[model samples]
Target: MHISEGVLSPPVLITGAAITLVGTWIGLKNTKAQQVPLMAVLTSTFFVASLIHVPLGPSSVHLVLNGLVGILLGFGAFPSILIALLLQALFFQFGGIIVLGANTANMALPAVIVYLLFKKLCISEKRRNRIIGGFLSGSISIILSGTMVALCLFFTGSNFNHAAKTVLIAHVPIMIIEGIITALVVDFIFRVKPEMLLGTEH
Candidate 1:
């Protein structure tokens, strides 16, 4: 759900840039030296996951894996997502430079919200609870990101209203797919390496 450069107005772009800067700063400040490796690994996961796009009716969607990153990184997801988006823009021009902050905010904000909302459930000792948390977080992240994209488009102009609605509808399947993938991933990681699940919020 990358918003292309020049698609948004100057005011929207400026607001996104300012908000994202604050988030990135907090993420950088809160990131611990020992956690750098984990952050790098999560960033790579996000970078790779969003590359393969699945064509939908009017647009294309991809696996953001933002929930997984959010659960594992907390506020750290901001910087991690920013770095991944930067690489995507630099090499592939996926989202472009001007809209980087807006795209970053769209994806990373949901993750941070998910972290706050479901951190305990995700890290719970109960497998079922963890799975439920994972599923919800994954699904919700996609939905929220789509909403943010729509909002950005709406703010750009009334002409984009139809496009905004279509974006949300196109992402329905993606939300389910991501939910299952995230749930399975969370379960596997919990079983294999429980300590790894102890994120920044813990």
Candidate 2:
């Protein structure tokens, strides 16, 4: 769901950049020292996950796992996504530098929201609820991010009907896979490294 440069108007790009910068700064400032290693690992995962493409119709998409990252890293998801996207741009040029703000906002904001939701669910003190929360968060995050992307395309004056249909259709199966993967991963982490999850104080 990477937006290439020159696809959006200059005004939209500038506004997105400003918002991204401010959000990223706040995320960085809020991150705790103990969360650094987990953030690093999640960021690496985000970077590597982009390389695994799944074919859908006439197009292909990659797993982002932003929901899982957000659940684990909380507000730290912003910086993790930003770093991962920067790496992707520098190494593979998956997204243009000019569109970095839009891309980051689209992907990372949903992650933050999902993280908050997951945190609340986990507060129930039940393993099943935590797992379900993670699962729902993962699924919801994909939808939110995907919808934002569609909105971006629409606002940027792309063929909204075509773009929305393409994105929605392509993302359906991918979202299911993402949710399952995220749930499994979250369960595994809870068993072996629960501290990695945000608000899980060991």
Candidate 3:
């Protein structure tokens, strides 16, 4: 979800910027030379996926293949998503510059969470477990990101309560669609390129 500029308070803005700076640094540090190209590809995927967004209240709804990015890149999702968001803001003004950090944190933090929670299951020996993990990773990451967006609005002001609820409710359908999409992609990767997923590279 892209939170518009001038919506969040100053404190929230600072907090988000801090989180993104540290996260992006760590992500860059963790990234290997060989993985740079893959990182670039995933960054573009995120950039394109989010370009087609439907406005929902103050924020917007769109496909965020963050689960795929996270499970594939781990901490690398931070830089990958950060770059995508930066480009979107620079070119399309999707989220604006001031609120860039908040938007990135809103979207990319869930990516890191999914990587930690579902990476092992996604890289599991059993096909069924991998599918389940993929589905959950995709679905839960959306839910988590949506909720974070709602909270940001709510924290900004009580007037956004309605918009916050709408944002969360709107994400339910996206979560399912993304879950199915991610499940299929993860299954294919397992068969054709299992090493592409996190924790399975070794």
Candidate 4:
């Protein structure tokens, strides 16, 4: 969800930027030189996925696939998401430079959380466990991200209450779609390119 510029309070924007800075630093630290290329590819995928979104009041609805990216990239998702969002802001002007941090934090934080919470399950030996892990990661990340976006708006002012609720409600369908997509993608990757997943980096 891309929260438009000037919608958030200054404190919220600053907090988001600070959080993203730390997350990106950790992401880069965890990223091996060998994974750089894969990181770029996933960044591109994330960039393209949100290109055709339906705008809600302060945010937008679209396929984030953050959980998919998270399970694969782990902490690497921070930099991946930041770069992609930077390009989107620069080229399409989807979100402004001022709001970039908040936007990045809103999405990437959930990705990191997903990785922390479910990466082990995603890389499990059993197919069923991996599938369930993938599904949860996909679905829960959306809920987390949507909640974050909603809170950002809600904290901005009472005037944004409706918009905040709307943002959460609109993403319900996307959560399910992302869950199914992530499940299939994770299972397919486990079979075709296992090395790409987080726990398999070794």
Candidate 5:
């Protein structure tokens, strides 16, 4: 679901860049020294997860684990996504530098939104609720990201039919896998390192 450079208009790309910069700044401001190690690990996990692609019809989908990142990192999701995407672009060529802002914003915004929704679930104190919230957050993150990508394509005057269909269909299986994985990971973290999540003031 990575949007390569030259696919979007300059105006759209500039807007995305501006927004991503602001988001990154906010995320950096919220990041704490103690969370650096966890952020590094989670960012690495996000990067590696993208490599495990599942073929779906004419397209391929990959697990993002963005929801789990959001749950664990809170507002720090912005920088986590920015760093992960940058690494992917530089090392894997998953996306281009010119389109980094749009791609990062597309993926990261959903994670941030999922974090907000999960926060509202009032599951901060309950184990089962946290697991369920993590699953739901992960599932919704893919859906939101896919939809945003479709909209971006449409706004850029691309033929939305094929792109939309491909994204929607390809994401279904990945979404399910992400939800299950996120739940399991969240549960594990809750058992072993609940403080990582609970420590987030947001």
Candidate 6:
């Protein structure tokens, strides 16, 4: 779901950069010193997971894992995702440097939102509830990210309406795939390493 460079207007790009900077600052400030290692691991996980793309009609989709990051990291997901995106842009050119902030914000904001909404369920003792939380968090994150991407494109020009729709539609399977993967991962972590989740208080 990376938006290439030069596709967005200057205002949108500038606004995105400013918002991401503030968000990353807040994320870093709130993240516990003890959680830095976990954050780094999750950042690498996101960076690698998104590299394996599945071909779609003309475009392709990849595993974002943003939902899992959000569930575990909360607002801290912003900085973690930003770092991964930066590497992807610099090393693989998966996305452009110009749109880095917009892409980071678009993906990370939903993660934070889902984390807040589903944090309780994710940490619940019941397996069923945690599973539901993971599925919803994973699925909704992709949906929201796709919508955010479309909205960004919408602001650029009316010609992008069809492209926006296509992007959203192509990600339907990704939503499901991410949902299942997130549920499995969350369940495993809860059982084997509950402290890894946000609000666990070590």
lDDT of 1 by residue, 98-165 (tens): 88999999998999999899888888899999999999889999889889899999999999999999
> lDDT per prediction?
0.87, 0.79, 0.86, 0.87, 0.80, 0.88
Give lDDT tens digits, candidate 2, residues 1-202.
8888888777778777886788788888988788678678878988888788867667776778989878877777888998999988898888888899988988889998987777677434577886788778778889888887877777777667688668766666778778877777787777776666535564
Kindly report which residue stretches of model 3 are placed more than 4 angstroms away from their true locations once superposed: 51-62, 198-202
Spell out the clash pairs found in candidate 6.
none
Q: Across residues 93-181, which tens digit of lDDT does each residue of candidate 3 receive? A: 78889898888888789989999999889988899998999999999999999998999999989999999999999889889878987
Off by over 4 Å in 2: 53-61, 122-124, 198-202
Q: Give TM-scores for every candidate, taking all chains together and pairing residue i with residue i.
A: 0.92, 0.87, 0.91, 0.91, 0.87, 0.92
Candidate 6 wrongly placed segments (more than 4 Å): 53-61, 198-202
Candidate 5 residue-wise lDDT, 1-202, digit = tens: 8888788878778877887888888888997787788788988988888778866567776778888777777778889999999988888787799899988888888888888888545245677787788788888898888887877777777666687668777677778878877887777777787666677444
Q: How many clashing pairs per prediction, in order?
A: 0, 0, 0, 0, 0, 0
Question: What is the lDDT for 27 in model 6?
Answer: 99
* Tens digits of lDDT, candidate 4, 1-202: 7888988999999999998999999999988898788788888988888765755457765778888878878788889989998998889888889899999999889998998899889889999999999999999999899999999999899899999999999778788878887898899998888887734445
Model 1: pairs clashing at backbone N, Cα or C within 3 Å? none
Judged by lDDT against the true structure, how good is candidate 2? 0.79
Report the alpha-carbon TM-score of model 1 versus the true structure.
0.92
| Cα TM-score of candidate 5 | 0.87
